[model samples]
Each structure stands twice: as C-alpha cells, then as structure tokens.
Target: MALVAQFLVADRVAVAFAKREMASQIRSGALADLPCDTPPPTVSDVSIGGFPFLTQVLTGSFSDVGMTMTGLPTTGPRIERISAHVRGVHVPIFRLATGGDGTIRIDDMRAAVHMTYADLNAFLRTQPGRVHITPVDGGRRLEITATANLPLLGDQQVGGVTTFAVHDNKVTLVPSEISLSGLFNLTLPLGNLGSYVPQIPIPVGDLPFKLTVTNASTDATGLSLAATATNIEVSTADQKPCRPTGS
Candidate 1:
C-alpha cells in the first residue's frame, strides 16, 4: 500500500499549498488573476489527522512564488483616510475682491495635507516613495511635494506629485507624480492664509477701526470718507481730503 499512501499524501499536500498561495495573493491584492481552474493550493489539512509527509509536500510547493506570476488577480489600491497640517513661512501677499457697494471680501487661503497610517501603508505598497501636488491659483500656479516612510510594510520611503490651477473661488487639484512600485500615493494637501494677509488697525479720531489689507487688491487700498458738520459747509476744493487747511 506504499503507492496508495504516497498518492494520498501528495494530494493533501497539494491542497494545502494551494490554500496558502491563495491567502498570500488575496492579502497582496492579486488573487483574482490566479487561474480559475487551479484550485487554491493547501497544506496539511488540519481537518484531517496529522500527516507530516503531506505537510512537507504542501510547504515545498510554494517555495519559489513570485509577485508577477500569471493567473493571479490584482486589486486596486485603497485609501482609508487622510489628514493634513499647514505652517506658513514667508507667504506672499494676496488680494481680496470688492463689491459694488464698496465692501471688501477676503478669501485667499493655504494649508497642508497629511495621511492616516492605514492609508499611508496601502499607498506605499503600490506607489513610489515621493509625490508632488499642484494646487489651484486664479491665473497662478502652485505645487507641493510630499515624502515619508512607507507604513505597515517597511521603513522604506514613498511619495507623489500633483499640479493644479486656481480660479475665481475654486482650487483645482492635479496629480503629477505616480510611482509604479507602490499601490498608491498617501500624501494629503494642506494650506495657510494668514501668511498672505496683513492686519493693520486704523484709529479714526476716537473710533478704532481695523483694516485687513491684502496687497494688490483694489479694495484693500480703498477707503470711503463722509463728514457732517453743524452750520459749517464741508466741501473740499480738491477731491482729496484737505489736510485741515492751515488755520
């Protein structure tokens, strides 16, 4: 019965090998590509009595597996979550828009992005160790680069690149960098606005007024003046406010 025993052991080992290979493929996001006809390999069937020889056969079956093997399916990279923080330094001045009624409106902003540990790990598995991002700027261009250590996998670094443009009130995001090595890019976008706006408090007589002026904006530089005096006609010879005509 030696031949019978050998066949049974071989079959059990084959099944076990298939199972392990299937598990690995699934975890790596590449199980769908595996040949449909080929049953998942299995090792020592724990369901059955101990079979040391069968286990050895199953273990030996997958000793030379590679990532690109044919018939195994591949899964798309997933994004769990993203977070970001922005610290502005030497930010350039910006301009704000004004309404027909002479009211000024400011809306310029800047910030930075960050990724969660789970998302970051998934990204590094599919993409490279570096990334770049481009943000929207009304007729202006901006770009950012992100880099960090790959999470959940190893100490290796990964990143991406993006480019975008800005319009009246919307910022467009552009993806510029994509790595083939990792599964995805985990970089988040962040921004800061205070860096571009200057706060200046103007004291008007006894009333303290605060004026936030953004460089290059018409509204930021415009100020309306109105005066009322009892029994005193107030009219400036020149449109400009007359420096109290000396005495």
Candidate 2:
C-alpha cells in the first residue's frame, strides 16, 4: 500500500510540472492577452500514460503525458477542453524535484481542443445580420436561419443546413440546404446567398513551438481540434526573471 501511495503522489507531482510548463509557455505565447483580465489557465486534469511513475523517473524518460487545460482562450472561441498526448518526454524529474533546473523535451505530441457552439456563434455573429446559426438535426447540423427583405417577396425568413469540414487547419462551413421556403411562390432577389461559404480561420495555426493542426471535427459540444508538434524543447535556461536587469 505504501508503494501505491508513492506512485499516486509522484503522478500528481509530475502532472503539476507539466501544467506549470504549459502555463508558462501560453502566457508568453501570442494569445496571452486573448481574454483580458481573466484568470490564468490551469491544468484541469492529467494522466501519466506509463505505469509506476518511479520506473519512468529512473529511466529519465516517459512514454506519454496527457493534459487537460482550462481558461485558455482563442480569438474566436473559448477553449473548453484541451487534451494533449505527449510521447517521449525527456526531462530530469529528479533534479527538478530537488529544486534544480533542466530542459524538458518531447519527441512528438498530439493535442485535441474542444470549443463550445456558443463561442463559435460569437465569431459567426460578425457576418451579415441576415445570417444566424441555431442548433438543429440533433445538433449534428447547424440550422442557418436568414431574414431578408426582397423586392416582390417582401420580408422572408429562410433556413438552410450547413456542412462543416476541416481544411488547411481551419473550419470550413458550406451551406447545403438553401432555398426560399415560404417565398417560393413569389420572385425574390436573394441572389446566391446560399453559395456563401464561411471559413473560420483558427488561430491554432500560429501556435507556439511550431505546433500544426492536423484535423478538426464538430460535435454536440463544439469543434474539436487535433494538432501535432515535433521536437519540442522547453528549457529552464531560457527563463526570464520577474524583472529585467534595468528595471
């Protein structure tokens, strides 16, 4: 039972280390000011992939490090859940545990981010007032309700189903079911409104340390982001003091 207790404690400490590193990097990254005056992001949860944390420490390498983050924001949507799977973590855990400094390196990592629909709507609201999105088709499809005034058809409310796809590290939405429902009996000047494709460029492409988004998907909760990075290195050597030399 003592061995098991040690393992649990070590797991918690290791997770805390990863969370600190992530917070440091994000605060120094590009989107640090995204949500002004908000609390800093913290580790929501973490799981060390290999069994027996002592074994990993002795070898000075870990197989996987899974992390979930909260309070991290993007320009368009608020990051709901962030799951990162890091493989081949090389860090001097013993030295760090003893108040020493070292570099933490990862050979590869895969991360997924979830954003809620309400956040996406904030971004979409920037479009023309005629376009509004509502959940539909069991939340699998977005019902785009549009209201516009036409010359002969008068004021009309139209709806369409939009298909979403991930491309070039961004979410691309294509209108699928577009038609003048109630105004079919009258002529309208709503020309090619359905042909509009709203491409939301995710800021993830500019992630720190050269992280690249591989794919994306939409779910009942929101958009899911999958990204990868190679040869990531975070070093204590690059640490900056709380105040500069001249300050």
Candidate 3:
C-alpha cells in the first residue's frame, strides 16, 4: 500500500510540476492562443500508472499519466480529464528541476479526459435548478433533474432520463425521458411548452489534449466521460515564475 501510494504521489508530482510551470508561462502570455478563459487554470488531481516512478523517469518513458483541471473558462463546456498514455517522454531531471530549457516528445501518445455533471453546471452560464446529473438503472439510464416553470402550471418539477453522446470533439446531452412532476398532482395536456426549454448549444467543456471522446457513464456523483489522443508534444524548460502581465 505504501509503495502504491508513493507511485501515485510521484505521478501527482509530475503533473503538478508541469501545471505549475505552464501556469506561470500562460499568466505571462508566453504561450498564446491556448484554451482556457484565463491563464493558470487549477490542477485538481493527477495520477500516473505503471508505477515505480524513478524507473520510468530513468527509462526515458512513462507508461501513463492523467490529470484533472478546473476553471477552464472556455466559451463551450470544458472537460477536465487530462490523461495520457505517453511514450518517449524524455526529460533530463537535473535540468528540468532547475528550470532549464528542455523539450520532450511522445513517440506515441493517447491523452484522455472526462467530466461530471457538476462540471457541466460549472460551465453553464445559467443552469436551471442548479441541474444535477446522476446515473441510475444499472448505468443503463441517466437522470437529469432541474427546475422548470410552465404557464398556468405554476412551478413544475423537472426530471429526466437523458443519455449523452460524444462526437466531433463534443458531448451532447440528449433527453430520453424528461419527466415533469410536482404539479400538485395536476395533469394538463401541455403541448410545445416542454419543447420551449431554455436549452442552449453550449459546448459545456473544453479539453487541452487532441483526444476523441470514447465512453461516458453516470455514477453517484454525476455524468462521467473519457477521451484519448496520440503523439502529443510538450516542453518542460519553458517554466518560469508566474507573474501577471504588467504586474
């Protein structure tokens, strides 16, 4: 268990170092045209697989690495599952630690990402009922609950079983069964009102890696998703002290 924890910690450290380094550059505008509303997004979690960190570092290749970032600030929805199956990751330790200029390339890379319904709400400018997403029915169905109001219906409760698909570098939340309840046990033949939902075509989440969404599911927390990519390029030596422009 201790060994496992250390491996996990090592992976976390690698990502944290990278995030910390790039955050400084982004805030300083060294790397432009990058995603994220503002520079220096938050690195929430990181994990590296195929442990025994020192061996991988010395071997000049890492088997896998993943990270979660928050505060993307993208116009569309932003997914934060920033993970990768990295190969040929060569970094000179002593120089990298000293903030020396170094470059690394992946012979083959498959990066990935996933997001939760809570992450969905965070990206949405105005979410109805502070929308919550959960998985039900043995992961065969998804439940989306929100608040809605109908004319002459007073305040109606809204819940739905929705399924989402990931294509074209985007995730689409499709409603399978939008259940309307909490109307004082009143049933009315409401037509076209439900269709007038304030649904917007927001991307919801954006990711940094060039990955394609592969799978999605719901759990106790919210909707989950995954994506993967290959041969990603990165630089380590560009890291510097994070100082806001004109500060």
Candidate 4:
C-alpha cells in the first residue's frame, strides 16, 4: 500500500509538468503571431513658388560610369500623422529634399529628407490613424492604402493616392506614376521622356526602403531608410541600426 501511493504521486507530478510545458509552447506561438507595428514619418508642408527645376550629370566612363539626375519638390504631403495598428504605435513624419530652391534638380539631387527612429516613435505615439499587420507564409506584411486632398503648385488642388507594402521590415511605395513634364524636363535621352520633354514621376517604385526593430516593447533599437534603386543592397558599411530614441 505504501509503494502504490508513492507511485501514484509521482505519476501526477509528471503529468502536471507536461501540461505546463505544453501551455508554454502554445503561448510562445501566439506571441510570434502578433503583427509588427510602426508609424510612417511626417513630411514637410511647403509650396514651390516657382517653376520646378531639372538637370542631369554623367560621371565615370564606359568601364565605370555613373549618372545622376535631380529636381523634385519636397513640399506637400507633410506627414501630419502616422499610426501602426499592430503594436498601437504612432510616429511623426519628417521631410528632406535633395535640391535647393525647394525643387529637386537633377544636377545636385541627393537625399534631402530623413526621419530618425526617435522621431518615428514619437509620431507613432501621437498618430490618430492605425496600422494593421497580417502574418503571411514567409513573414509578416503591412498594407497601407489611402487618399487625401492636397494643394498642387501652391494654389491648385489635386487628389493624391498613396499606397505601400511592408514585408520583412522592407517598405515599398506602390503609387501610380505621375507625369514629370509639368514640373521639369529631362535633358538626357532616357527612354520614354526624350521626345516629350522628359518628365519623371515620384519614382516610388525605384526607391527601396527597409526597417529593423529590436526590443520593440521599449522601442530600443531600429534602423530604416528610403533609398534609391542604385543604392539598395546589403553591405557592411551601409548597414545602419537606428534606435527608437532618434539617435
């Protein structure tokens, strides 16, 4: 009788331990399913008071050559607010322009806009909208589609549509192409715009962007950027780890 009682107690303890282990595994899976949330950065709300400028420059040679073009307005669509639904995060938008005179010119076109992670977190905290993330096969994805009424060339009003997709910490802007002729003319013999006085759209498709989040609970570390098609690659020197504190 004493032996049987001891055996029974051991069996019950083993069963309870197994049940607890299983429960822990289930909880971990649930947390992994949670979506990643991040807010889009805010942009400037400026107006171009004059004609948009355009220019192009060629560097290197047949063996090693590079060409650069610039001239785009950084005004308008100042990100008023951004909301990331998955984590209930909000962030403010920041704007940078490559060209002077408020117009992006081809000659000196460089990244003039940048948003730090700290600013992003603040915007996320204050944004009124929400971002929703869904789990997909390989990883998670975020989709944003919205429209707004904005002023064009200062006084003229126009409707603008914005769409984006975030996957594996990479963000892709998917917007319809816009005509560049109205703003500026390209001097180069680039394909479609040569005969028609060359116009360039926002080139959202050509821009590659990515975001990295670490310790999201505390907004500890992060890095993100909107880069040009030519410079979108993984390299040791280019890797930037942005922290949530805007550092």
Best by lDDT: 2
Off by over 4 Å in 2: 1-39, 94-101, 146-157, 181-202, 207-209, 237-247
Compare the candidates by TM-score and give the number of the best one: 2
Model 3: per-residue Cα lDDT over 70-131, one tens digit each? 55545655654444444444545445546565655545545444455566766643654445
Residue 154, model 2: Cα distance from true site in angstroms = 12
lDDT of 4 by residue, 1-247 (tens): 9987876676555434433332222122112212222221222221111111010011100111122112211222122121211111011101111211111111111122232334433433333222112222222232222221223433211122223444443443332222222234222232342222211121122221221321111112222232321211222112222356645
Q: Residue 92 error for model 4, in Å?
A: 44
Question: TM-score of the candidate numbered 2?
Answer: 0.69
Q: If the candidates were sorted by their TM-score against the true structure, best first, what order would they fall in?
A: 2, 3, 4, 1
What tens digits encode model 1's per-residue C-alpha lDDT throughout 112-201?
111222332343334443333233343133333334332354433333343322333222333343232345544433223212111112
Error of 2 at 106 (Å): 1.7
lDDT of each: 0.27, 0.61, 0.53, 0.24
* Candidate 3 residue 242 C-alpha distance from true site, Å: 5.3
- The segments of candidate 4 whose C-alpha lies over 4 angstroms from its true place after superposition are 1-20, 26-152, 155-162, 166-168, 177-247
The ten-residue window of minimal lDDT in model 3 covers 24-33
- Candidate 2 residue-wise lDDT, 128-212, digit = tens: 4346667765567677766545446556666666656666666665556655667374433335643343333445554444567
